[model samples]
Target: MKVPVRKQPSWFQVLLILPGVAALVVTFLFPLLWLARTSIQPTTGHTLSLHAYARLFEDSFYWWVIGRTIFIGLLCVVITVPMAFPVALFLARSQSRWRGTLTALAIAPLLTSTVIRTYGWMVILGRHGLINTTLVWAGILAQPTRLDNGPFATVVALVEILLPYGIISILSHLSRLDTELEQAASLLGARRLQVFWRVLLPLSVPGLMTASLLVFVLAISSLVTPQLMGGGRVFVLATEIFNQTTIALDWPFAGALSITLLGFFGIFVALYQRILQRVESQS
Candidate 1:
């Protein structure tokens, strides 16, 4: 018997994909090229230079900002992953009627505007706002303290904003898990915790890792939440880029900063891919 050869992609298929390709070129490729060009240009001269990068490396303030951005991103991922795990597990394992309701509640924040949500957080965490007011009323403190306009509030708002994404990523993997593997583990004298730690967690590592990356990317790339919550006190790379571009009108400097931010994000993505590939190969 002869094996059937697959047909090549037809003209229609090419046409169908052409629009998407065009859109990508227009929306992403062109801008990326432009950014690359701009990053090397000097502010005073038409000729390209490495002055921006050299200056960035030399500046202690820039280093501090970059360090803080990475720290906050990692911290947000750490906070989000553990919290999201429970919600995802509940969504995956339970057949309860409240599952849908709980899931809706978890995701409902996503429907609201991020700016509005940040504002809400501002109200909640502010010195005279809900939390502090209530605490003071109950005599928990002598006076209300400033929670708004700080790094803590920035992370808190980011956690609240990005929680659903982590839950969804893990939930997708959890939903597709083989129940029989879990049953088999249970029959093999493994306790519930043992089965989870060894079997479920291993199986779910890809999803967990993916969710963590998503959280980190969102947290690091985030401008609005950090700006609002930190109240200009938190000087992240994105906010600095915004300042360079809009406030300072330094396009070349902004481009260089953008390149730096992209480089960091790329490094993170590469590290995760390498680690995840090793994990997958072992599994």
Candidate 2:
């Protein structure tokens, strides 16, 4: 008997992906190309120059801002992951009837405008805001303190805003986990904490890494929350880019800053891939 032959997908099947490819090129690739071109081009002439990059590297203030941005991103990841882990575990493992409602509640903040949420945080963290007023009323302090125009307020608001994303990422991974593994570990005389640390936690590293990456990128790229909550005190890259674009009308510098931010994205993504590879190899 002759060997059976397999048919390949025809041109029609390949054509189906063209629209998506076109959309990606238009939306992502085009913008990236524009940014790259603008970053090197002179503000007045068509000639290319590294002046913007030179200025960026030469300025100590810009270095400080970059360091601050990285610090805030790391801090957000650290705070958001642990806080989200329990919530995600509950959502994933719970058999409660109200699970859907609880999940909705967890993500409900995303429905509201970020501007409105930032403004709400402002009210809560302002000098005469709820915390200060309650503290003073309870005789915890003599007066209201300035809380809205600093890194503390920025981090708090960012955590609240970014928490849902972390929860969602971790929950996605947790939901797919095998309950049998935990049961087997328990059967082997492993305690609940041990089972989690040794089995579940190790398996859940990918989700945690994804959540951390999301929160870190969002925290670093965030503009409105940092701007309003920082009350002009915070100077993140996003805010600086906005300032360069709108206030200073320095489009070339703005583009350069944008490219720098893009570089951060690329660096983190590479780091995440490396870590993920190691985790998978060990597993």
Candidate 2 lDDT: 0.94
RMSD of each: 2.4, 3.2
The digit string of per-residue lDDT tens for model 1 on 55-140 reads: 88899999999999999999999999999998899898989999888888878888998999999999899989999999999999
Residue range 1-283, candidate 2, lDDT tens digits: 9998878978997799889999999999999899889889988978899999999999999999999999999999999999999999999889999999999999889999889988899899999999999999999989998888899999999999999999999999999999999999999999999998999999999999999999999999999988999888899999999999999989889998999999999999999999999998987
C-alpha positional error of residue 34 in candidate 2 after TM-score superposition, expressed in Å: 1.0
lDDT of 1: 0.93
TM-score of each: 0.94, 0.95
Compare the candidates by TM-score and give the number of the best one: 2
TM-score for candidate 1: 0.94
Per-model lDDT: 0.93, 0.94
The residue-level lDDT of candidate 2 at 233 comes to 88
